[model samples]
Target: MAGIVACVLLSLVTMVHSQVQTAFLEYMQSRMGSVEERIAQWHDHSSRYSSELRDFKNQVLKMLENIEKEREAMRNEVESTNVRVDRLEREVDYLETQNPAPPCVEIDEKLTELQIKKKKNEKYEKLTDCSDTVSQVNAMKILKRFGSSAGLWTKDPIGNSERIYVFDGAANDTFFVFPRMKEFTLSTSTRKAARIKLPFPWIGTGHIVYGGYLYYVRQTEEFQVIKFNLANKTVDDSAVLPIEDQVPVYGLSKHNYIDIVADEEGLWVIYATRENEKNICLAKLDSKNLGIEQMWDTPCPIENAESAFVVCGTLYVVYNTKLPSRSRIQCIFDVSGTISSENVPVVYFPKRYGSHSSMKYNPKDRQIYAWDDGYQIIYKLSMKPKDELH
Candidate 1:
């Protein structure tokens, strides 16, 4: 009976062990299948994520390329605009000349005197370019040319004596006056021509005049106020400036420009200084304290007022006005205002006109002479008596 009972226990234990082993195998299989399914799903998700990331990167690269192209295009446009502005400013220079231009000023009686040497003797003739097509009536004619050879030609305040002074062009650049003599023969052994030296290389532009042993500049890029003493023949390097209590455009730039004139009372220098785009200063040197006492600003940029002069204390500004169509009008400023259709008269030309030069006012003759490139041409003007000028 004891042996049978032991056998039953052993069998029961074995059966129990088998059942536990089978259950453990089924659990292991189920866990392995779930792991495989999860692994497949993770691989598919990773592939899809990688493809999407690549597409996003490509879109970002395209956007960056577009931004770079836009930046380059803007840079090119800005560069082009700057180039155009520079060109327009260059055309505003005063020295620029047109091919076939208009007249500078109106020519009238009293001012058309041309000192010509017809024969060996001096003869006064009406100054007119026979080539001129404009209508001109014969005013009184006079011959003032002396048999003396031509010398330096400059405009002066005094209208009498010689409307134009002539000196040898070969005169050295030392300020010396021509002795009031026509012919001189200092023996054939020692031949000295009648010549004077200017202080400096007579700067090639503007009206240059000689009087009171001083050389004057009607217009130039140099300082507006300069003097060449005939006694010493040296540039008054002292470089007297008309503006005392004023600032300059830069440390190097000066205020003097265009024209200058001198009389017994003092010297007058007309200069241009730009303040803004629209405002331009036309300062008049008073010469009292070596500074500008009176200054006037104009809206229009004066083309060239150096050819202008004061008559009876009234200032006349000569300038060229460019119309909308680019046609130019050479006009003069009067006492009325800077520009007025009634007061501002257009310079009269026949077939055409050309460049300009220095000008002078003859208070005695009541006329204005422009030292033009062609020759001296006269214009009639209505002005008050000189004595009335304060």
Candidate 2:
């Protein structure tokens, strides 16, 4: 019975050990399966994360490539702009070197001859005759008269009676002032006169006395206007007359005559071309620098404009008509630079004496003085009223 009990106990112990072993093995198997599933999920998650990282890197590379392309385009644009600026600078430099100073004189071809002629002939009549004449001795007395005439006269408008100014260029090449009225007498040989010497030997073509100074034009290689101070008796300044391109070069021929006159405004240089193209050019000067301020070219050429003088801004040109007897005609030109078709009647002077005559306008007396050096006489005439003349 004791041996049977020992065997039964050992079997029971064996059975318990087998059961515990089975339970432990089943628990270990379940744990292992869970660990295997976790490992597979981790691998799938890592693959997805790597694919996402690669796509992010590709996007970054594309953005970098776009930025580089934009930078290159901007650089190219800047280089093109720099090249254009350099080219523009070079062009401006070339233009400045090619032409330094341009001409100040401007041309206006719109002005017509008919317009000028109409202005000139507005006052066709009312030009008075040369009714009065004065000898050189009684030259001052002629200024007191009322009638319109042309003559030589001297009156001390400045109240300086100690000396008298004379426009006579015949007795002396230079302008002269006499101390006494008797000195101006052509017949008197004993009377003395003071002469204002010029810088060069000049043939006085035209002259005017203004602001106590004498202004005249001398013909040299070209016409030059010389200003002589009457009080100081010194040549103040001089300038060459600006001739137009159409005008012929200087010569000793008949085409070289230039007439210069001045009114209250300033000086005027009048000249005409020779031959068929008798183009007339008038230039207004700047008194300070003697530069050309304004210029006008006549619409049509004048036939024979021997001498010219300005009065009340009207230009009167003396024309010698050899035909129908030797007589002189006064052609009027308005300020518009138009010649009159209707010839104004003037106190006729012989064509021989016309060359020696100097026409001048006295603003104070409002009369025109024609100094006839050939006859040694002066003719005086009054300017007609604008209403009557026009």
Candidate 3:
């Protein structure tokens, strides 16, 4: 009975071991198949990515080739333009060599014929901006040094009166009147000059005696043009200037508040009146009533400018350094359109005592009376048609 029981137990153990081995083999086979499927999917994805990369590379190569072609075309165009420019330059050089420039005398004659000047009396007329331009400052004669470094001295622009009036400073009540130019030039003392007193003290260096009347800026106003009789020493008329901003007329000057000048067209004034405070403002005044007849916003700026003078309705702003170097006419604004900055040549004043305090242009003598650092000066000018200027 014991042998039979042992045999049954062994058979049961063998059956259990066989079943476990078959289950392990089935699990291994399932796992291997799933892994193989995953590997196949990965391979397919890599192949698609590779194909897309190749397509992108080809597109990039095509774009680069097109860029190179455009670059070559641009290079060719630039080369063609350079060649044409070279040819034009050569042609210009050849033409210049063939026809040399004419003499200055002949050129002046031709320019005089071509240029149309504005008549002093003509109020309105169409004309070119090339009538007459200042070429050279021929002679600079320093008359004498009087009073302070800043003053004004000038003869009456109109009449044949050789009398010269001298204002000794930017602010003053009295001025000296000389009998004649010769007497003033020879005398070193102020005793010889007749002292004339103004009813009101004047301010700034923009004062001038014209037509027996002294035009100046009065001390009691922000900026007023005062017409005083030189003979009677009384105020004839007064007008407020239309200054947009409150500043000096010349930026470099300390007392050139507003400039009252006289040209061929009569009384005028120069000031800065723009909102931007840029260019100078010119106004024409009626000598009788001292009313504004016309106004022109000129293009001449007040920068580094010490003074200005008008000739035949043309405004010439004179520029100089505060340290006192050479003075030059940097801007020209003509109301009649007969003179422009481009039309005029670079006009430089000869070096003298110092910067000019006041410069007055006389149409009668065709000269400039200037006061430079207390020294009275006469600048002889060379005028010519614009075409004759270089």
Candidate 4:
């Protein structure tokens, strides 16, 4: 009986120990699953933070590149400014050397006298009737016979008191120089002559002699004012007058002619356009570079203006007349906006209207020269007050 009871007690102890082992195993499995879940969440958060950091780094790189490019652009701009300033300084020094300071004089009195002269010149009025007597008028006889189809006669631009220049456009494009004297008679010789060849073949309309150079229009695609240097006998392409954009349909036809005149104020280019509502443009040329300095536009008084000339800063437009009673109509305009519609008497020329007729005023002689190209004769009219008789 004692042996049997000991065996029963051993069995009971073995069963209780197996139950305790099973409960311990179940608790350990639940704790391990919770820890594994927390670890997985941490790993996901780390990956997201890494991606955000990479995007921020890329943005910083782009910003740095932009800043670098801007710095380079600023450096280039500063360098260009410095170069321009240096060039300007050099130009200023050269101009100073060319024009020296004049001697001191009566400043106030000289200024007052200049003001008075300016006012007097500004108050220009149409003078009395121009003389109609051809015989009584002083004539400048053409000494040299040029084969010119078109010509302009004007006073010497070099300040020679007794000389005149004749720019013959079609006569082999020659420039004839004539000398004035006490007696006037026709001759067959010239004091000096020069041949001017333009880039184009067409002859220009109006011509002006200025500072040993002859300025005329080059009837090219764009009506360009060409400067022919007599000293070098070369055409200065750099000194072309800027008028292409200033005029409408610049080189449309021969009728759109450009008239050039030079006076105390410098060179002037005058033209009337039919396209721009028949407006007239007057441009003051830069004497040194032949650039347009100042421009003025006004309504044209006459249509199909044949010729334009300026005297004492006053502009005159001449129109052709076919009627026997009327020879030519002269329209005077003051560009300073002072005078308008001043009726100046027209001088009658009997059967002298030609296609290539031109008129010029000689300030030194105070005479008006009208060229009759058809007859190859130049008729002179005196502008002097004494010569005007009713």
Candidate 5:
């Protein structure tokens, strides 16, 4: 009886196992079908996309062909226009030759008035008895090897100290101060200059040294002026004037937003504004607090100005070309209304390595110390009396 029960249980277990196997086979087939269906859908989408890609490519090629045709038509039209213009110019020349009429030019009354005024006020147009003109520029000496091509080197225009300050680029924190001008021009070692670090970083090579104080534009959006006391290496004072940084003061010098300069008239700041990008704005800066005492909207356009400096409250803006060549003082603005810009004549700097990065007019020396390329140079001015120009 026990043996018969064991055979029945074994038969029941085998039947259960066969049923499980059959169910698993059906599940696997369903899974395979699902996978096959997804594969087919993917193939169909890929084919459609490929066809669309081919159509897009064909359309692009057609558009390109149309563009080429239009370009060719425009080129031909331009050539025809040029020919017509040449013919018109030749006809005009012939007509002018036959008629021999005086050249008709709309003269500017304002300019004529200015010329008249300049002639009348020629004697009064002076800083002292007469403002000196840059008669000659001498690249007397080149400084030690600097990594950059643009830099600044200036001596104190107020004190009797023979110390010289140097800057390598527009943006820097450390400026080297040499004991004397001779040591600065001749020495190659960095040890010769006492590296003075600033609490606030300086922007642009447009820094000036005067009365034992180093005045520089603080590296900020406002381009605030900072007076760094050389005697103590401490921040003496700072002032922010109404100046825009949207456009640099000079087009060529994109980094020099504000230029601080000192002359016989004391401290001054030169800058450009977004509202008036074409013209330069001048402000008299109080050296004690770097405060704005007076402001002037100059007629001197800032478009081609590369550098500028103040002398006897008169701003001498130096202009340069896109291609580096001889820089010239093309514009002048006198705050006192005593000097006439037209009468002064255009002053040019002698051909050098390149454009000026920094130009500081030393009132004590009555010379302009400029950084041309990487070389330091000085411009000697010939102060001609107004009576002599007559």
Candidate 6:
């Protein structure tokens, strides 16, 4: 019985040892698998972080390169600006050193005569744009004989049909009219040309309608102002300008310019006297009395001023200056005193080689037509914006 107890106890001890060994072996195998999994996770995380760091470094390097390029471009722009500044300064200094003078008037008489003849021939045609044939046809025949009637001023709009007033300087005593046809039979007046007598020969100055008379200048050193009665179509000697006013000023070298115009107020005369130097004077005279009512002296020493017809009570003087004697500057003055505190002058252009009579303004179209004596061509001026004046 004791021997049987010993064998059973030994078997129990062996079974316990075998169970402990199996449990230890299972625990060691599980720990080894966990350690290997941890190493693999650490390696994967390290590779991801290294790749991200390399991408960030490349982005930073590209940004730095772009900044350097921008800095270099700015430096080049600054250098170019400095060079332009230096070049402009040098050019200004050179211009100041030269200090050029204005050009003198080159009055070539032969050229002037040729230009006058050409203009006369070109404008002489009787462009009678009338609806009636009797008057228009008869008038054109008379105008053609005159060669250049000096009427039908194109300064007016192109399509206007008005009976044009004609004047003859060679026969300074006569004027003619081209009437528009209203009936098949011509008006007795239309068939026969109108005739009038002048105190002198040459109606060179622009004429104006005033006090039922036509006032114009004669081409002579003395007594230039003459008048023709429009109602009678005859010259009235008693209606001539006053003898006292006609007398030239003392020390006056030449008759610079004489312009007459009649408005709602009365007759107005503007003439420049060459009393040592040119001085412009305005005289508002009574059409009948031939007496001056108001006079004002222009501020500018006009070299030569041309008189354009008055419009809307404003008198405009187109003048050119001969400054010290190289560049020709043309000036237009509004003598009406409506635009400014004083008479305002507007500069037009340089080298105006044209005639005063040749310059025509059609206010309806806002176009300026000029007959260029130098180029022998007619030019139409383009409209300019006010801001472009400077």
The TM-scores, one per candidate, come to 0.40, 0.49, 0.64, 0.51, 0.64, 0.39
Question: How do the residues 6-65 of candidate 2 rate in per-residue lDDT, one tens digit apiece?
Answer: 999999999999999999999999999999999999999999999999999999999999
Off by over 4 Å in 1: 1-152, 155-193, 207-211, 217-224, 231-237, 240-256, 262-266, 276-280, 286-290, 304-306, 319-353, 380-390
Off by over 4 Å in 2: 1-173, 180-182, 244-256, 264-266, 274-279, 299-302, 322-327, 336-356
| Better TM-score candidate (1, 6) | 1
lDDT minimum window of 10 residues, candidate 2 = 131-140
How big is the positional error of residue 324 in model 4, measured in Å on the Cα after superposition?
7.5
| TM accuracy, model 3 | 0.64
lDDT score at residue 218, model 6, on the 0-100 scale: 69
Query: lDDT tens digits, residues 298-354, model 4?
Result: 454445455655655556665554432334435555555544434355544444435
What digit string (tens of lDDT, one per residue) describes model 6 on residues 1-390?
Answer: 999999999999999999999999999999999999999999999999999999999999999999999999999999999999999999988987898656788989899556533432121111222111000001101112222322212222323544444443322555555543232114433355444545555544345544456666665445456566666766664333322333222111123245565433345665554442444555555566555455555543444543333332334455543331212223222234433213233434334333333233334433333323212122333333222332
Candidate 3 backbone collisions, by pair: none
Weakest 10 consecutive residues of candidate 6 by summed lDDT:
132-141
- For residue 226, give model 4's deviation from the true position in Å: 1.7
Instruction: Give lDDT for model 3.
Output: 0.79
- Tell me the lDDT of model 1 at 97: 53
Give the better candidate number (1 or 5) by TM-score. Answer: 5
For all candidates, the clash counts are 18, 12, 0, 1, 0, 8
Q: Candidate 5 — what's its lDDT?
A: 0.79
Any runs in candidate 4 off by more than 4 Å, and if so which? Answer: 1-149, 161-164, 169-172, 178-185, 189-202, 236-256, 302-304, 322-326, 342-356, 374-390
lDDT of 4: 0.56
Predictions in order: lDDT: 0.42, 0.52, 0.79, 0.56, 0.79, 0.45
> In model 2, how large is the Cα lDDT of residue 113?
37
Error of 4 at 300 (Å): 3.1
Residue pairs in candidate 5 whose N, alpha carbon or C atoms collide under 3 angstroms: none
The window of 10 residues in a row where model 3 has the poorest summed lDDT is 113-122
Model 6, CA-based lDDT: 0.45
